[model samples]
Target: MTRKYIDCREFPSEMNCTVAISADSEKELLEAAVQHAVTIHHHADSPELRAQLVTLFHEGTPPTEAPRTA
Candidate 1:
């Protein structure tokens, strides 16, 4: 697992963010991104965000959670 730090300082200027993870494939990247979001950004990342991150990092698929049927 080779980790990379993506410094998105050029685009989305407001976000002074850095993503560090070992993502060999597309799926890994998405998972890492979500983890980064929840743990660091504290953002309840939407599915759209997950998809975008997948495209950006070219890694893992984001895991889907089943809706709670109370």
Candidate 2:
């Protein structure tokens, strides 16, 4: 069995989170995401945030900061 690691940075104030999960397969990644959200964000099982976390992980796109035009 191969274990994977997911780098997650959650910001509750911003209502945005960044998660970089790397697993042997998508299945493992999803599992990890759920656990992480629950433990870190205090999201109980079947919470909406869990789904959102999974979606963010699956999307595989990091959050980007907009440039200031000043």
Candidate 3:
């Protein structure tokens, strides 16, 4: 199965976080991403946030090169 990833740098945040989460499935990625969001970004856990995160999900492993901010 293909891996999934969520890059914090892709999202808008006051912290400008550079964290990137990966998992074997979307469900796992969502769970981990949400926890990181709540704990590190001080975001409230909600369905809306979960849905937004769903849109940010990408297939395959995260890039080893630095994330592009522009």
Best by TM-score: 3
Q: What shift in Å separates residue 66 of candidate 2 from its native position after superposition?
A: 14
Q: What is the TM-score of each candidate against the true structure?
A: 0.50, 0.47, 0.88
Pairs of colliding residues, candidate 3: none
lDDT of 1 by residue, 1-70 (tens): 5443332332342455533454565565567668877777776879987876655552332224322222
Sliding window of 10 residues with minimal summed lDDT for model 1? 61-70
> Can you write out model 2's per-residue Cα lDDT over 1-70, one digit (the tens) per residue?
4644444553333544555557766577778778776776677878576566555542333334421222
Which candidate number would show the highest lDDT if scored against the true structure? Answer: 3
Give the per-residue lDDT digits (tens) of candidate 3, residues 1-70. 9999998876567777888899998999999999998999888999999999999899998887647776
Best of the two (2, 3) by lDDT: 3
Q: Quote model 1's TM-score.
A: 0.50
Arranged by lDDT, best first: 3, 2, 1
**lDDT, candidate 1, at 25:** 54
Residue 50, candidate 1: alpha-carbon lDDT: 82
Clashing pairs for predicted structure model 1, backbone only: 25-59, 26-58, 26-59, 26-60, 27-59, 27-60, 27-61, 28-60, 29-60
Total clashes in model 1, counting residue pairs 3 or more apart in sequence or in different chains: 9
